[model samples]
Target: MRKLYVWDPLVRAFHWALVAGLILNMFVTNPGKTAHRWLGYGVLTLIALRLVWGLIGPKFARFRSFPPDPAAALDHAREIVTGRVHPHEGHSPLGALMVYNLLASCLIIGLTGWMLTTLTWFGVEWVEDLHKAFVTWVQLCAVLHIAAVIFESRRLRVNLPKSMVTGYKTLP
Candidate 1:
């Protein structure tokens, strides 16, 4: 086995921060409270920072490291079907799609949530419903993300979640 530094500090921080913020908003913070709004804003800020980091951050942190390629994702799926192991130092192709999905979902949720606070959108049923719908979408994506991480970690013989926490992946 070899150890490789994968996730950078900022990337790790963003991952855990997003996890915490989502948990807080989903359970602890009431949507009607000022604290909830601030927390949501904080999450939006984190997402913005992450987007910038994906452009200029370290090698593995950059989006260039894992461009969204449908063919590559299909190949990864084939590898899984054939019981072949090909571990990526950064994100696997399917994982990249999930990252993009979560980012877009969060942005929509944040924007809709902010719209709810505006005079024009305040108490607008559809806008509020859109916000709630995205929240649910995020929640579903989070579950799928976790499941995929676990599956990949086992299939690749790497502690994927640990890599996020410690910025290192022990690969065989």
Candidate 2:
């Protein structure tokens, strides 16, 4: 199998770190103040780092490569539906959309969460509910992201989960 170093080191690191932080921050409910704050900070840092990485990274990792362009994204999606096996070198259409959605939603989640900690917004019941709702949406997006990965891996006959772990994908 041909091999390619598609994802940069920082991108892969940020991806896994965010995954861990989000997962831990999701299930651990003993929000004894410090733990909750630390988790939010961790997520914020991960997102910030990812933003930097995307700006100055390799071809596939660059924001220019994956910015949400509706026509192209939709055409690629249509190609996939029409059974055209394109030699896709970077993020696929649906994957790109998912990435954008996750990024925007997570930013909102982090902002609202951090806002809740501010003295000005402290004890605001609506902010609390908003944070909780965004967290739930984050979890749902994560699950859907995984399912998409699994489906794409199977369709492409590539072990994408392992590729993310190893930062390498065997090419066509």
Candidate 3:
């Protein structure tokens, strides 16, 4: 067993903060419109920060390390199907997909949420519906992501939950 500092401080901070904001935004955005608006703004800010961090962050956080490689990702997917999961220093193929999806979906979700609060869109049914719809999509994706994390963590004997908190993963 070897120790690997995969997730850095900034990355960990961004991860937890974003999760909190997303959950809080979901609740606040519905009942308390004003709190919802602020939460949405916070989400937008977090997304922007993550974009920059992905570019300039540490080894595992950088985009260059996990840029979508369809072929390799597919191979990893195949391996997973065959019950040979591997914990490659950073996010595995499907995990990478979830990462990308989370960022993109959150961006769209946050943007739509913000749009609904604008002057011209006030009390607009369609905009609100679209925003709500995106939230549902995000919610579903989040659930799947968590399940995948738990599965992978168990299979690999990795402390993924703790790693995210401590910015360290003891590689197997």
Number of the top candidate by lDDT? 1
Per-residue accuracy of model 1 over 93-150 as CA lDDT, tens digit each: 9999999999999999889989988899999999999999999999999999999999
Clashes in candidate 3: how many? 0
Candidate 3 weakest lDDT stretch, 10 residues:
25-34
lDDT of 3 at 80: 77
Candidate 3 TM-score to native: 0.92
Give the TM-scores of the predictions, in the order they appear: 0.98, 0.92, 0.92
lDDT of 3 by residue, 22-115 (tens): 8877764564377877877887898899899888888799888888788878998787789885778887877888888889988987777777
Better of 1 and 2 by TM-score: 1
Q: lDDT score of model 1?
A: 0.93
In Å, residue 104's CA in model 1 sits off its true spot by 0.5
Once superposed on the true structure, which residue ranges of model 2 sit more than 4 Å away at CA? none
For every candidate, C-alpha RMSD to the true structure in Å: 0.7, 1.5, 1.6
- lDDT pick, better of 1 and 2: 1
Best by TM-score: 1
Q: In order, what lDDT does every prediction score?
A: 0.93, 0.80, 0.83
